[model samples]
Target: MIELKALNKLHISSFYKWLNDSESIRYSLSAFQKTNSPDEVDVWFQSVLEDTKGLNLGIFLRDSEQLIGFTGICKISRLNKSGEYFIFIGDKSQWNKGIGCEVTRLVLKIAFCEKGLNRLMLTVSEPNIGGLKAYQKAGFTPEGKLRQACFRDGAYHDKIIMSILKNEYLKSVKA
Candidate 1:
């Protein structure tokens, strides 16, 4: 139902709107700051394009080819063979469709099989129930929690640190 592609300038407008949408960023770090304008998004996009250690892709609907979200493995460490994974489905209409779990599996394949990475990690706010479930479905296990690490909706929430090792990912795919 969706495909991942390298984000281009054409996706800037949609990205700008998603970044500023309150509900879209409710459980993310984006909630803590403001995305003032499209220019700022353009700058951020440029940085993503330039980052050699990161891989950011736009999630597009297969039928309509609409840019609904983004996913990436960032802060990739060559020596350690690990990276931080993140995703956001900005289009609220697409929520709870199992897309998050599908995307997580795709990213896991890229990190462990394609990139030869040893591990992949991510953080999700405790209140993001869907995200927590999706990550678990993709074989990530909680490593720990950062108490009150995320503040949203007038309160603080724990941030769960989750990870999957390459060997674990390989075993998962075999089954």
Candidate 2:
């Protein structure tokens, strides 16, 4: 099982490492193409901690209490009642284990139930098949695509936009 708690300084080092990891950051739209410096991670971490519009959580294993990755909603707009959702599983060993899907569900619950958001959305690169599959499994439907929006791996990739509204989420959880 997976649970999300407020991200703290204790998880900063692992978060830094994950941000710098080539394999992990490859799919992130906001991540720089190169490894980030420790100072950069510190600055970003502080911003995340201070940002009231965002909810940055550390993803942990329920039993072992191990920090594996980070997940949250950012660019939150209260007037719009919308936010962009994101997740990164830093523990590469834990990939392909359905952890992403479980975390997605947990985040959705927080967004709609706790935070009272109307819509949650995400963007995935075309090459990120695994991540795309996980989001789809979490009940996000593809809304649109940005052609050649992301440049990665020596080529440009399209960004697939997906979203789930509050009503859709309520219906899903009820079924």
For each candidate in turn, the TM-score is: 0.95, 0.94
- What does candidate 1 score on TM? 0.95
Error of 1 at 99 (Å): 0.8
State residue 104's C-alpha deviation in candidate 1, in Å: 0.7
What's the TM for model 2?
A: 0.94
- Look at candidate 2 and tell me the lDDT of residue 80: 95
Candidate 1 error regions (>4 Å): none
The candidate that wins on lDDT is 2
Can you write out model 1's per-residue Cα lDDT over 44-159, one digit (the tens) per residue?
A: 77787777779898898999999999898988999999999999898999998988888888888888888999999999999989889889989999999999987788998899
Instruction: Please list the residue runs of candidate 2 whose C-alpha ends up more than 4 Å from where it truly belongs after superposition.
Output: 32-35
Candidate 2 local lDDT, 66-166, one digit each (tens) = 99988899999999999999998988888888899899999999999999999999999989998888888788999999999998878988999999999
The local lDDT score (0 to 100) that residue 33 gets in candidate 1 is 56
Superposed by TM-score, candidate 1 places the C-alpha of residue 22 at a distance from the truth, in angstroms, of 0.4
